[model samples]
Target: MHQQSAGQLPAEVLAAFQDEQQQLDAAGIPAGVATVGSVMPDGDLLDAHGEPTTLTAARNGRPAVVVFYRGAWCPYCNIALRAYQEQLQPALATRGVALVAISPQTPDGSLTMQQTKELTFTVLSDAGNQIARRLGILTAPTEPVRQAQAALGLDLTTVNADHTPALPMPAVALVDTAGVLRWIDVHPNYATRTEPAAVLAALTTLD
Candidate 1:
Protein backbone atom coordinates (compact mmCIF):
# COMPACT_ATOMS: atom_id res chain seq x y z
CA MET A 1 0.00 0.00 0.00
CA HIS A 2 2.78 2.42 0.88
CA GLN A 3 4.58 1.45 -2.31
CA GLN A 4 1.44 2.33 -4.23
CA SER A 5 1.26 5.70 -2.49
CA ALA A 6 4.92 6.41 -3.19
CA GLY A 7 4.40 5.53 -6.83
CA GLN A 8 1.33 7.71 -7.25
CA LEU A 9 2.36 10.73 -5.20
CA PRO A 10 3.72 13.74 -7.03
CA ALA A 11 7.41 14.49 -6.73
CA GLU A 12 6.86 17.70 -4.77
CA VAL A 13 4.71 16.03 -2.14
CA LEU A 14 7.09 13.11 -1.77
CA ALA A 15 10.01 15.50 -1.42
CA ALA A 16 8.18 17.35 1.31
CA PHE A 17 7.74 14.11 3.28
CA GLN A 18 11.39 13.27 2.82
CA ASP A 19 12.39 16.68 4.13
CA GLU A 20 10.23 16.16 7.17
CA GLN A 21 11.84 12.78 7.82
CA GLN A 22 15.25 14.39 7.68
CA GLN A 23 14.16 17.01 10.17
CA LEU A 24 12.81 14.32 12.50
CA ASP A 25 16.10 12.46 12.30
CA ALA A 26 17.89 15.63 13.35
CA ALA A 27 15.52 16.22 16.28
CA GLY A 28 16.14 12.78 17.77
CA ILE A 29 13.93 11.01 20.30
CA PRO A 30 12.90 12.90 23.39
CA ALA A 31 15.11 12.69 26.45
CA GLY A 32 14.11 10.84 29.63
CA VAL A 33 11.39 8.98 27.80
CA ALA A 34 9.73 5.87 29.18
CA THR A 35 11.40 2.64 28.15
CA VAL A 36 10.96 -1.05 28.85
CA GLY A 37 10.26 -1.84 32.52
CA SER A 38 8.62 1.55 33.03
CA VAL A 39 5.00 1.85 34.01
CA MET A 40 2.65 3.07 31.27
CA PRO A 41 1.49 6.61 31.66
CA ASP A 42 -2.10 7.25 32.68
CA GLY A 43 -4.42 9.74 31.02
CA ASP A 44 -8.13 10.49 30.78
CA LEU A 45 -9.21 9.51 27.28
CA LEU A 46 -12.55 8.95 25.58
CA ASP A 47 -13.68 5.71 23.99
CA ALA A 48 -15.52 5.42 20.71
CA HIS A 49 -18.70 5.66 22.78
CA GLY A 50 -17.56 9.07 24.08
CA GLU A 51 -17.28 7.67 27.59
CA PRO A 52 -14.30 8.54 29.76
CA THR A 53 -11.73 5.74 30.05
CA THR A 54 -8.11 4.84 30.47
CA LEU A 55 -5.75 2.36 28.85
CA THR A 56 -6.07 0.09 31.85
CA ALA A 57 -9.82 0.00 31.49
CA ALA A 58 -9.42 -1.05 27.91
CA ARG A 59 -7.09 -3.81 29.02
CA ASN A 60 -9.73 -5.09 31.46
CA GLY A 61 -7.20 -6.93 33.71
CA ARG A 62 -5.38 -8.42 30.74
CA PRO A 63 -2.09 -7.53 29.10
CA ALA A 64 -2.48 -5.02 26.29
CA VAL A 65 -1.09 -4.11 22.92
CA VAL A 66 -1.60 -0.39 22.38
CA VAL A 67 -1.29 1.20 18.97
CA PHE A 68 -0.82 4.92 18.48
CA TYR A 69 -1.95 6.20 15.11
CA ARG A 70 -2.22 9.62 13.47
CA GLY A 71 -5.96 9.87 12.78
CA ALA A 72 -8.87 8.67 10.71
CA TRP A 73 -7.94 11.15 7.98
CA CYS A 74 -4.71 9.27 7.34
CA PRO A 75 -4.87 6.50 4.77
CA TYR A 76 -1.80 4.84 6.24
CA CYS A 77 -3.46 4.69 9.63
CA ASN A 78 -6.55 3.07 8.13
CA ILE A 79 -4.52 0.46 6.35
CA ALA A 80 -2.51 -0.30 9.46
CA LEU A 81 -5.58 -0.59 11.65
CA ARG A 82 -7.34 -2.93 9.25
CA ALA A 83 -4.29 -5.08 8.88
CA TYR A 84 -3.94 -5.38 12.63
CA GLN A 85 -7.55 -6.38 12.97
CA GLU A 86 -7.37 -9.04 10.30
CA GLN A 87 -3.94 -10.41 11.13
CA LEU A 88 -3.02 -9.54 14.70
CA GLN A 89 -6.13 -9.34 16.83
CA PRO A 90 -6.82 -13.04 16.86
CA ALA A 91 -3.32 -13.87 17.92
CA LEU A 92 -3.52 -11.26 20.64
CA ALA A 93 -6.85 -12.65 21.79
CA THR A 94 -5.34 -16.13 22.15
CA ARG A 95 -2.75 -14.58 24.40
CA GLY A 96 -5.47 -12.94 26.47
CA VAL A 97 -4.23 -9.52 25.44
CA ALA A 98 -6.42 -6.68 24.27
CA LEU A 99 -5.64 -4.61 21.21
CA VAL A 100 -6.33 -0.91 21.61
CA ALA A 101 -5.82 1.79 19.03
CA ILE A 102 -5.33 5.42 20.07
CA SER A 103 -5.39 8.64 18.06
CA PRO A 104 -5.74 12.37 18.60
CA GLN A 105 -9.08 12.42 16.82
CA THR A 106 -12.22 13.14 18.85
CA PRO A 107 -14.40 10.36 20.20
CA ASP A 108 -16.85 10.95 17.36
CA GLY A 109 -14.13 10.56 14.81
CA SER A 110 -12.90 7.47 16.59
CA LEU A 111 -16.36 5.98 16.45
CA THR A 112 -16.61 6.74 12.77
CA MET A 113 -13.30 5.09 12.09
CA GLN A 114 -14.06 2.05 14.23
CA GLN A 115 -17.35 1.45 12.45
CA THR A 116 -16.02 2.25 9.00
CA LYS A 117 -13.11 -0.10 9.51
CA GLU A 118 -15.29 -2.74 11.16
CA LEU A 119 -12.81 -3.00 13.98
CA THR A 120 -13.69 -5.24 16.92
CA PHE A 121 -11.08 -3.91 19.32
CA THR A 122 -11.10 -0.81 21.44
CA VAL A 123 -10.54 2.54 19.76
CA LEU A 124 -9.90 5.57 21.94
CA SER A 125 -9.37 9.29 21.49
CA ASP A 126 -6.38 10.76 23.22
CA ALA A 127 -7.46 14.33 23.62
CA GLY A 128 -4.56 16.79 23.71
CA ASN A 129 -2.21 13.79 23.41
CA GLN A 130 -1.87 13.58 27.16
CA ILE A 131 -0.69 9.96 27.13
CA ALA A 132 1.48 10.26 24.03
CA ARG A 133 3.24 13.30 25.43
CA ARG A 134 3.96 11.44 28.63
CA LEU A 135 5.34 8.56 26.56
CA GLY A 136 7.47 11.05 24.58
CA ILE A 137 6.18 9.99 21.18
CA LEU A 138 4.18 13.02 20.11
CA THR A 139 5.45 14.89 17.06
CA ALA A 140 4.23 17.99 15.27
CA PRO A 141 4.36 17.97 11.51
CA THR A 142 7.11 20.00 9.92
CA GLU A 143 6.09 23.16 8.09
CA PRO A 144 6.71 21.57 4.70
CA VAL A 145 4.78 18.43 5.63
CA ARG A 146 1.92 20.51 7.04
CA GLN A 147 1.81 22.57 3.86
CA ALA A 148 1.80 19.44 1.75
CA GLN A 149 -1.02 17.93 3.79
CA ALA A 150 -2.99 21.18 3.52
CA ALA A 151 -2.49 21.12 -0.20
CA LEU A 152 -3.80 17.57 -0.20
CA GLY A 153 -6.98 18.84 1.59
CA LEU A 154 -6.09 17.35 4.97
CA ASP A 155 -6.26 19.95 7.69
CA LEU A 156 -4.71 18.47 10.82
CA THR A 157 -6.22 21.10 13.08
CA THR A 158 -9.71 20.08 12.00
CA VAL A 159 -9.09 16.35 12.42
CA ASN A 160 -7.19 16.41 15.68
CA ALA A 161 -9.16 16.67 18.91
CA ASP A 162 -6.70 19.09 20.50
CA HIS A 163 -6.51 21.27 17.37
CA THR A 164 -2.73 21.31 17.83
CA PRO A 165 -1.88 19.69 14.50
CA ALA A 166 0.40 17.21 16.29
CA LEU A 167 0.46 13.42 16.02
CA PRO A 168 2.07 10.53 17.80
CA MET A 169 4.64 8.56 15.84
CA PRO A 170 2.94 5.31 14.82
CA ALA A 171 3.84 3.02 17.71
CA VAL A 172 3.00 -0.38 19.20
CA ALA A 173 3.68 -1.00 22.83
CA LEU A 174 3.07 -4.17 24.84
CA VAL A 175 2.10 -3.58 28.45
CA ASP A 176 1.92 -6.32 31.06
CA THR A 177 -0.99 -6.74 33.45
CA ALA A 178 0.93 -4.64 35.94
CA GLY A 179 1.04 -1.74 33.42
CA VAL A 180 4.76 -2.05 32.79
CA LEU A 181 5.89 -1.75 29.20
CA ARG A 182 7.44 -5.01 28.07
CA TRP A 183 8.04 -4.16 24.43
CA ILE A 184 7.63 -1.17 22.14
CA ASP A 185 7.96 -0.19 18.50
CA VAL A 186 8.04 3.48 17.56
CA HIS A 187 8.24 4.28 13.86
CA PRO A 188 9.52 7.70 12.88
CA ASN A 189 8.13 7.37 9.38
CA TYR A 190 4.42 8.03 9.27
CA ALA A 191 4.17 6.01 6.08
CA THR A 192 5.19 2.83 7.93
CA ARG A 193 3.81 0.83 10.85
CA THR A 194 4.68 -1.92 13.28
CA GLU A 195 4.09 -5.21 11.53
CA PRO A 196 1.62 -7.68 13.01
CA ALA A 197 4.10 -10.55 12.80
CA ALA A 198 6.58 -8.57 14.86
CA VAL A 199 3.89 -7.80 17.42
CA LEU A 200 2.97 -11.46 17.65
CA ALA A 201 6.60 -12.35 18.21
CA ALA A 202 6.77 -9.82 21.02
CA LEU A 203 3.68 -11.32 22.58
CA THR A 204 5.25 -14.79 22.57
CA THR A 205 8.11 -13.55 24.71
CA LEU A 206 5.70 -12.23 27.31
CA ASP A 207 4.27 -15.74 27.73
Candidate 2:
Protein backbone atom coordinates (compact mmCIF):
# COMPACT_ATOMS: atom_id res chain seq x y z
CA MET A 1 0.00 0.00 0.00
CA HIS A 2 2.84 2.37 -0.65
CA GLN A 3 1.66 5.80 -1.67
CA GLN A 4 1.26 6.28 -5.39
CA SER A 5 2.57 9.78 -4.79
CA ALA A 6 5.84 8.35 -3.54
CA GLY A 7 6.67 6.84 -6.90
CA GLN A 8 7.75 10.17 -8.39
CA LEU A 9 9.66 11.53 -5.41
CA PRO A 10 13.21 12.83 -5.95
CA ALA A 11 16.23 11.59 -3.98
CA GLU A 12 16.07 14.26 -1.26
CA VAL A 13 12.36 13.77 -0.80
CA LEU A 14 12.85 10.02 -0.43
CA ALA A 15 15.57 10.65 2.15
CA ALA A 16 13.19 12.82 4.12
CA PHE A 17 10.59 10.07 4.03
CA GLN A 18 13.13 7.54 5.26
CA ASP A 19 14.08 9.84 8.13
CA GLU A 20 10.43 10.26 9.11
CA GLN A 21 9.81 6.51 9.11
CA GLN A 22 12.80 6.08 11.42
CA GLN A 23 11.29 8.48 13.93
CA LEU A 24 7.95 6.70 13.85
CA ASP A 25 9.61 3.31 14.26
CA ALA A 26 11.50 4.55 17.30
CA ALA A 27 8.26 5.71 18.91
CA GLY A 28 6.96 2.11 18.74
CA ILE A 29 3.55 0.96 19.99
CA PRO A 30 2.06 2.55 23.07
CA ALA A 31 1.95 0.30 26.12
CA GLY A 32 -1.61 1.24 27.03
CA VAL A 33 -3.04 -0.09 23.78
CA ALA A 34 -1.08 -3.35 23.77
CA THR A 35 -3.41 -5.41 25.94
CA VAL A 36 -6.32 -7.41 24.51
CA GLY A 37 -8.79 -7.80 27.37
CA SER A 38 -8.90 -4.16 28.46
CA VAL A 39 -12.10 -2.15 28.44
CA MET A 40 -12.45 0.36 25.63
CA PRO A 41 -12.07 3.89 26.94
CA ASP A 42 -15.01 6.28 26.76
CA GLY A 43 -14.63 9.61 25.00
CA ASP A 44 -16.75 12.41 23.58
CA LEU A 45 -16.62 13.21 19.89
CA LEU A 46 -18.79 14.92 17.30
CA ASP A 47 -20.61 13.12 14.54
CA ALA A 48 -20.66 14.41 10.98
CA HIS A 49 -23.68 16.48 12.00
CA GLY A 50 -21.68 18.11 14.80
CA GLU A 51 -23.77 16.26 17.36
CA PRO A 52 -21.94 15.06 20.43
CA THR A 53 -21.51 11.29 20.60
CA THR A 54 -19.90 8.97 23.11
CA LEU A 55 -18.26 5.58 22.69
CA THR A 56 -20.32 4.08 25.51
CA ALA A 57 -23.57 5.22 23.93
CA ALA A 58 -22.55 3.70 20.62
CA ARG A 59 -21.60 0.39 22.19
CA ASN A 60 -24.90 -0.01 24.11
CA GLY A 61 -24.71 -3.80 24.70
CA ARG A 62 -23.90 -4.49 21.06
CA PRO A 63 -20.53 -5.48 19.63
CA ALA A 64 -18.61 -2.70 17.89
CA VAL A 65 -15.84 -2.31 15.36
CA VAL A 66 -14.06 0.97 16.02
CA VAL A 67 -11.60 2.19 13.42
CA PHE A 68 -9.15 5.04 13.78
CA TYR A 69 -7.77 6.48 10.58
CA ARG A 70 -5.56 9.43 9.67
CA GLY A 71 -8.11 11.56 7.78
CA ALA A 72 -9.92 12.19 4.50
CA TRP A 73 -6.83 13.61 2.82
CA CYS A 74 -5.15 10.22 3.02
CA PRO A 75 -5.70 7.99 0.00
CA TYR A 76 -4.79 4.87 1.98
CA CYS A 77 -7.39 5.76 4.56
CA ASN A 78 -9.97 6.24 1.87
CA ILE A 79 -9.29 2.80 0.39
CA ALA A 80 -9.50 1.12 3.78
CA LEU A 81 -12.70 3.00 4.66
CA ARG A 82 -14.45 2.04 1.44
CA ALA A 83 -13.41 -1.56 1.97
CA TYR A 84 -14.95 -1.50 5.44
CA GLN A 85 -18.18 0.03 4.19
CA GLU A 86 -18.56 -2.40 1.32
CA GLN A 87 -17.43 -5.56 3.06
CA LEU A 88 -17.02 -5.45 6.83
CA GLN A 89 -20.00 -3.21 7.56
CA PRO A 90 -22.49 -5.59 5.94
CA ALA A 91 -21.09 -8.59 7.78
CA LEU A 92 -21.15 -6.71 11.09
CA ALA A 93 -24.73 -5.60 10.45
CA THR A 94 -25.87 -9.20 10.20
CA ARG A 95 -24.42 -9.86 13.66
CA GLY A 96 -25.86 -6.65 15.17
CA VAL A 97 -22.45 -5.00 15.42
CA ALA A 98 -21.86 -1.32 14.85
CA LEU A 99 -19.07 0.03 12.65
CA VAL A 100 -17.67 3.44 13.42
CA ALA A 101 -14.71 5.45 12.12
CA ILE A 102 -12.94 8.20 14.05
CA SER A 103 -10.38 10.78 13.04
CA PRO A 104 -8.90 14.06 14.27
CA GLN A 105 -10.56 15.91 11.45
CA THR A 106 -13.29 18.45 12.24
CA PRO A 107 -16.98 17.80 11.80
CA ASP A 108 -16.89 19.44 8.39
CA GLY A 109 -14.08 17.14 7.33
CA SER A 110 -15.97 14.18 8.67
CA LEU A 111 -19.06 15.29 6.78
CA THR A 112 -17.02 15.63 3.61
CA MET A 113 -15.61 12.17 4.09
CA GLN A 114 -19.01 10.62 4.73
CA GLN A 115 -20.58 12.29 1.72
CA THR A 116 -17.60 11.70 -0.54
CA LYS A 117 -17.45 8.02 0.32
CA GLU A 118 -21.21 7.61 0.66
CA LEU A 119 -20.63 5.80 3.91
CA THR A 120 -23.78 4.91 5.84
CA PHE A 121 -22.06 4.27 9.15
CA THR A 122 -20.99 6.83 11.72
CA VAL A 123 -17.94 9.06 11.16
CA LEU A 124 -16.83 11.02 14.19
CA SER A 125 -14.46 13.91 14.72
CA ASP A 126 -12.16 13.28 17.61
CA ALA A 127 -11.19 16.83 18.25
CA GLY A 128 -7.95 17.39 20.15
CA ASN A 129 -7.37 13.65 19.69
CA GLN A 130 -8.95 13.08 23.08
CA ILE A 131 -9.79 9.45 22.31
CA ALA A 132 -6.42 8.68 20.72
CA ARG A 133 -4.62 10.27 23.63
CA ARG A 134 -6.68 8.23 26.08
CA LEU A 135 -5.92 5.07 24.16
CA GLY A 136 -2.20 6.03 24.03
CA ILE A 137 -2.19 5.74 20.23
CA LEU A 138 -1.57 9.41 19.59
CA THR A 139 1.51 10.39 17.55
CA ALA A 140 2.85 13.57 16.10
CA PRO A 141 4.32 13.78 12.62
CA THR A 142 8.06 14.19 12.34
CA GLU A 143 9.38 17.58 11.24
CA PRO A 144 10.45 16.24 7.85
CA VAL A 145 7.04 14.67 7.27
CA ARG A 146 5.38 17.90 8.32
CA GLN A 147 7.51 19.74 5.79
CA ALA A 148 6.60 17.19 3.15
CA GLN A 149 2.91 17.57 3.94
CA ALA A 150 3.16 21.33 3.67
CA ALA A 151 4.97 21.03 0.35
CA LEU A 152 2.18 18.74 -0.90
CA GLY A 153 -0.42 21.38 0.12
CA LEU A 154 -1.75 19.19 2.87
CA ASP A 155 -2.20 21.67 5.65
CA LEU A 156 -3.35 19.39 8.42
CA THR A 157 -3.62 22.36 10.77
CA THR A 158 -6.58 23.64 8.78
CA VAL A 159 -8.27 20.24 8.47
CA ASN A 160 -7.77 19.00 12.01
CA ALA A 161 -10.31 20.08 14.62
CA ASP A 162 -7.74 21.38 17.11
CA HIS A 163 -5.12 22.44 14.55
CA THR A 164 -2.79 19.85 16.07
CA PRO A 165 -0.13 18.25 13.87
CA ALA A 166 -0.80 14.72 15.05
CA LEU A 167 -2.46 11.51 13.96
CA PRO A 168 -3.28 8.06 15.28
CA MET A 169 -1.63 4.96 13.89
CA PRO A 170 -4.32 3.22 11.81
CA ALA A 171 -6.07 0.85 14.17
CA VAL A 172 -9.13 -1.32 14.66
CA ALA A 173 -10.66 -2.60 17.89
CA LEU A 174 -13.34 -5.26 18.14
CA VAL A 175 -15.38 -4.87 21.30
CA ASP A 176 -17.68 -7.53 22.69
CA THR A 177 -21.32 -6.94 23.59
CA ALA A 178 -20.22 -6.39 27.17
CA GLY A 179 -17.85 -3.60 26.00
CA VAL A 180 -14.65 -5.50 26.68
CA LEU A 181 -12.14 -5.40 23.89
CA ARG A 182 -12.06 -8.77 22.15
CA TRP A 183 -9.52 -8.03 19.43
CA ILE A 184 -7.21 -5.19 18.41
CA ASP A 185 -4.99 -4.43 15.42
CA VAL A 186 -2.78 -1.39 15.20
CA HIS A 187 -0.62 -0.72 12.17
CA PRO A 188 2.47 1.41 12.50
CA ASN A 189 2.61 1.86 8.77
CA TYR A 190 -0.06 4.25 7.53
CA ALA A 191 -0.09 2.42 4.19
CA THR A 192 -1.31 -0.78 5.85
CA ARG A 193 -4.78 -1.48 7.23
CA THR A 194 -6.67 -4.29 8.87
CA GLU A 195 -8.20 -6.46 6.16
CA PRO A 196 -11.99 -6.72 6.09
CA ALA A 197 -11.78 -10.51 5.99
CA ALA A 198 -9.56 -10.54 9.07
CA VAL A 199 -12.03 -8.32 10.92
CA LEU A 200 -14.91 -10.61 9.93
CA ALA A 201 -13.01 -13.62 11.23
CA ALA A 202 -12.35 -11.85 14.51
CA LEU A 203 -16.02 -10.97 14.84
CA THR A 204 -16.90 -14.59 14.24
CA THR A 205 -14.82 -15.55 17.28
CA LEU A 206 -16.87 -13.22 19.50
CA ASP A 207 -19.98 -15.34 18.89
lDDT of each: 0.86, 0.81
Q: Any runs in candidate 1 off by more than 4 Å, and if so which? A: 25-31, 111-117
Best by TM-score: 1
Listed in order, each prediction's TM-score against the native is 0.91, 0.89
Clashing pairs in 1: none
Off by over 4 Å in 2: 1-3, 8-11, 22-27, 111-117
Best by lDDT: 1
Model 2, span 115-161: residue lDDT tens: 55689787888888887777778887777777877877788888899
39-91 per-residue lDDT for model 1 (tens digits): 99979999988899999888888999999998888878888988999999988
User: In model 2, where is the ten-residue run with the lowest total lDDT?
Assistant: 108-117
